[model samples]
Target: MVCRVSGILLAVASAAAVGGCGGEGGPTSPPPPGPPPPPPGPTIGASLNLRPGEVHVLSERDAIRAFEIQGAAEGREYQVIVMSASLSEGRTTPLRVRARADDVSPNVVPNARTNRSGRDAAIPPARGLAGELRPDRDWHLRQMIETERELRRLRARPAEGIGRASRGLAAAVSDVPRVGDTLTVRSAIVPGGGVQCTANTPIKSTVRTVGEHFIIVEDDRLAGRFTEEDYADLDRELDEFIAPVSHEYFGEPDDLDGNQRVIAFFTGEVNRLSEPESGSVVIGFHWIGNLFERENCPASNEAEIVWLIGPDPDAEFGIEIGVDFVKRVARSLVAHEYQHLLNASQRLGGQRGQDTWGNADLWINEGLSHVAEEVTGFYRQGLRVRGNYGYTELIAGDPDLVAFRDFFEGNLENAREYLSATTEFNPLALNNNTLDFATRGWGYVFVRWFGDRYGPAGPGGIVAGSGEAALYRELAVGGPGYLFGYENFLRAAEVVAGETTTWGDVLAEHFAASAADDAHEALPDGAQFSTWNWPRLWEELRTAGVRGLTGGDPLRRRIIQMGAGVSSTDEFDLGSSTARYYHLRAAGGHPSMIVETTIASGGNVPNSAEARIIVVRTR
Candidate 1:
C-alpha cells in the first residue's frame, strides 16, 4: 500500500522500525509492478539540499553524534538518525551522493541473509516510516540499513585491498559467459536494470571471442547498434591504442598469452540503463563491499576485467560536441577504464584488491589515469589531450570574465550560482571539476609534479600499498616514538626537494616567478600573481601568505586560520555586490583545506546577511 503524503506516495518499511517519518493523513493505494527510481541519496548526512559552500550546523544539545542514511527501494522509506549533536555547533559541508541500485529486499533471496550471504543483517537497528507498506518493511529496511552501516563502517576502517562489495558480486562473475558462447545476466550498474533479477530474467549477452589479451562481450541490444566494421574498428582500436597505454604505465598485461584475457562488456543506452548520475559512458569497477566478508568476484576468474560500455556520442552525458569529440571521449574512456583494470590487477600486485576499491582516494587513482591519457604526450598523435587538458585547465585556472559578469554586477545568489556552475563543470572537486573528472585534470598535474620531483614510482610507491598506511607513511607526525608518518607533505617535500623549504616556498618560486609555470600551471594564467581581477581575493591570498596557490595543490599550500596573519574571518566579506574565493590550508587540529566565500553586502544571500562559510577537506 502507498500512503499519500504531501501529494507524494510514501511506502513505509516495517512497523518495528524506529525513527520513521509519519505522513499527515492521506489515501492509500496498491504498489505498482515496478516503481520509478528514487533520486540520489545524501552523502554522509541528511538531504538538506545545501549548496557547496553552505554548512549545516547543529547545537550541542542534540543526541545523535553521527548517523547515516541508507536509501533502499524506490518506494520504501526507512527512518535513520542522520547525526548527533555536539557541545559546540557542528558544521557539515555539502557532499554529492550517488543513488544505489543494490537496495532491493535483501533477505528474500537465497543465501542473502547477510552481506557475505547477499543480505545485510549485521547493521544497527533502524525504524520504518509510519505509512503504507509497499513491500514487507523488515527485509528491505534490514537490507538498506545494514548495507549503509557496513559501507560507512568500512569507509572508517583502514584500506585492505580491492574486492567485491557483496557476495552478490561473486554471482556477477559466475554469470559470465565463456568466449564463443551466449549468456544472460542482470544489469547491476545500468538503470532500469532490476536489482532482484535472476538468471531466468537477465540482460541478453554474448562473448564472441576471448583473445590472448582480451575477452569481448556485448549486450544483445548494443551489438545491434554497431555493424561488423564498427566492431572490428573498435577491437582494433582497443588492441592498438588503449591496451598499450595501460601496459606502459601499469606494467604489462597480466597475461600476454591467450590463456587468461581481460573481459570487456559493452552495453547500449548506458545513461538510461542505470541511475543517470551514477551511470557513466564507460565504467571499470572492482567490487569492494565493506559490509560483507571478502568474496571472489568476476567469479569466472578472479583476474577478469569487467567493462560496461556506453553510447558513441551520447548527448545525455553532456557530449553534444561532434564525432571527433565522441571518438576522443571513447578513447579516453577506454584508457581510463583499462588503467583501472590494471590498477586492480592482482597479478601485477599493483595495490588493487577487494579492500582497495573506493579506499584509494580519487585524487590518486584518477590522477594516474589522467597521466595515462598523456603517456604519449597531450599534443602528440593518437592522443587527444586538447579536450581533456584544455577544458579542465580552463575550469581550473582563472575564472572566465564573461561567466561572472552577471554575478559581479548582480547580487549574492547570482555569485553563488555562478561559482556553483564553475564547480560543476570541473569534477575532481579539488579543482572545480578536478573531482568530477574523477580526479583527472588537476590530479594529472599532481602526478606529473610528484613524478618529476621524486622519480618513476615517486609517490606512486606509497599508493601501490594500503591507502591509510600510505597516507600516514608520507605525512609527518610530531611524536617521540613515531618512525613513520611525516607531519604532512611539507616535511616530505623537504626530502623530495632536497631543501629546508616547504612545498609552499617551492611552488611560489616555480609558479609565480618562473616561465615554466605556464606549462606546469594548474590554475588559469591570471588567477596567480597580481593578474587576478578580484582585489579582495588577491589581498587575501597574499595576506594568507598563499599566493597563486589553490586547493588543486597536492601539498595544500595555503593555510587560513582564524587569528592567523591572513586577515580576520570578518575580512572574508567583500561588501554587497561582491564575490571572492579564498584558499587556506587547514591548520592545528583540523587537517582539511578550507574554501570560504564571502558575501558581505548582498541582499540575495539566503543565509546571514553578514557572511557565509564552507570548508573543503583535501582527502
Candidate 2:
C-alpha cells in the first residue's frame, strides 16, 4: 500500500509541475534572480588631519574615497599605506603611500587599487598639519617631528646652538640681503646737559669733551653730519690752524687747551672792570664763513662779538685763524678793548670828551690803539699808520693830500668842498670819488712822526713799555706836555742845537768826517789825518767862508759851508751827519774834515789850489 501511494504522489506532483510550466510557456525556467546588484563601489579606507609640528592618521573613509575616485569598476581592491609626510613654513609637505592589488582579469583590476600608493604620495599635507600625528598616513611624520623639536630647542637656546644655525642661514642668504656702502650719523645739541645723536644703528656713547666739547653722532641723511673718518680729518685740520697761533699768543699747548681759556680771559677782564657786560661773546673756532656778524649776535649778549674760524688749509692746527699775524691782530684788538675797559674803570678825563658825531674822542683812542699795534707787533712790520682813507677815490682822481687832510680833520669849509674831498674819512659814503688813501696815508705818517719825536728817549722821551699807560703818563707830564702847551717843541730842539754850535755845524762836521774816512780808505796808508794831529788845518777852514753879519767871528760862515756840504753829498753819506757830529762834540772830541774838487784843466787862476781846503776843530 505505501509503495502504491508513493508512486501515485510522485505521478501527481510531476503532472502538477508539468501543467504549471505548460501554463506559462513550453519550457519555463525558474524565475531569473533579480538582476545581479551592481558590483560594490570602492570604499573609503582612511583619512588624515594635520596640525603644526604634528602628524595624524588618515581615516579609512578618506582612503576608501581616494581609492574610489582613482579605481574603476572592473576589479577594485587596495591596501593603502602612507610612506611619508612632511611640512614646513613656506612649503607643503608631500604624502607618500604604498598600494597593491590583484584580480582575475587585468582589465577588471581597478586603477585605484593598482596606483593607490602613487596617488596618495602625490597629495600635499593639509596646511597647519604636522607630520608627527599622521604616522599611519605619513611615515615621515616622525622624522619631521624630530627635526622640528631640534629646531625649537635651537631657537629656545638662541645664545648657544642658534648662533651656528643663524650663521648658516645668513650664509645661505648672503646673496640676497646686501650691506650698504656708507653709513651716517646725525647729532644735535640738547637743551640741557648733553647731545643727542642718531645713526643707522642704535648707539649710545660719551665722547671726550676736552677740545670740541659738544659732539654728537649723526645719521647719514642729516646734512653736516660726519663719520669717524671725517671727524678725524676735520680734527686734524683744526689742530693745525690753532697750533701756531695758540703757541705764539697763549703760551704752550698745555696752558691754553681750548676756546674756553680765551673766553674766560676776556670775560674775567670785563668783569674786573665792573662795566656792564652787554652780550655774550661766541667764539666759534670751527665756523669758517664770516668771522663776525653784528646782526646775528646772540640775545644773551646783543653787543657781543663773534669770532669764527675756518678749517686750516695747512692741517697743522685744528684751529681757525692759526696764522701768526691773525693771532697778533686778535690780541691787539682784545688789548685795545681792555684799555677802554681800564679807562672806564678809572674814570679818565679824556673818556668824557665828545667828537662831531657825538662819539667820544675816537681819534685819540684809535690813534693810541694804532700805535699800540706797532709796539706789540700785531700787524705786519712797518704798519704804524692807518693808510687808506682816500685810496678808493684816488682810483678816479689824483689824490689831493690837502683835501684828504681836511676831510680827516672833519674841517670842510663848505658842504660842497666836503663832498669833493676823498671819501676815506667818510667811509659810509661809497661815492665814486671816495678814496681809501686817507686812512693809509694819514694813519702811518702821524704815528711815525709821533714815534720819531716822543718815543724811547726822543726829546719828550715817551717810551712804549707797558702799552699806552706809560705812554700817556709821559705825554701828559714830560717835556712833551710843556713843549706842546707852548707850541715850542720844534723850536726848543732847534735852540738846543744852535746853542751847542748849531745843528748846521754838527751836520757839517759829520759829513766832513765821513768824507775823510772814505777818502782815507781809498788812499795810500800815510795820507790819512787825525783830528788832533791836523788841528790847525781844521781851525783855519772854520773862518774862511763868507763872513756873516750877526756873528763876531766867521764860525757861522763855516757852519753854513758844512751844511752845504751835507746837502750835496747825503747819498754817499752812510751815517746821519747831525747824529755823528752831536755825539763827537758831546764827548769833547772833533772829527777830521776835508774838501776835494776836480777842476777842468782850462780853468783860470794858474798855480792856484783847484779845491779849497777847510778844517774845523771845536773841542
- Could you give the C-alpha RMSD of every candidate to the true structure, in order shown? 24.1, 57.2
**Candidate 2 Cα errors over 4 Å, as ranges:** 1-329, 332-363, 378-437, 454-619
TM-score of 2: 0.21
Q: Which stretches of candidate 1 lie over 4 Å from their true place?
A: 1-180, 183-186, 190-202, 208-212, 252-259, 273-303, 312-328, 346-360, 376-441, 455-516, 519-570, 573-619
Against the unseen true structure, what C-alpha lDDT does each candidate score? Answer: 0.31, 0.22
lDDT for 489 (candidate 2): 22
Quick one: RMSD of model 1?
A: 24.1
In candidate 1, residue 193 scores what lDDT?
32
Model 2 Cα lDDT, one tens digit per residue, 240-272: 332222222212211111122111011111111
Query: What is the lDDT, from 0 to 100, of the residue 355 in candidate 2?
Result: 14
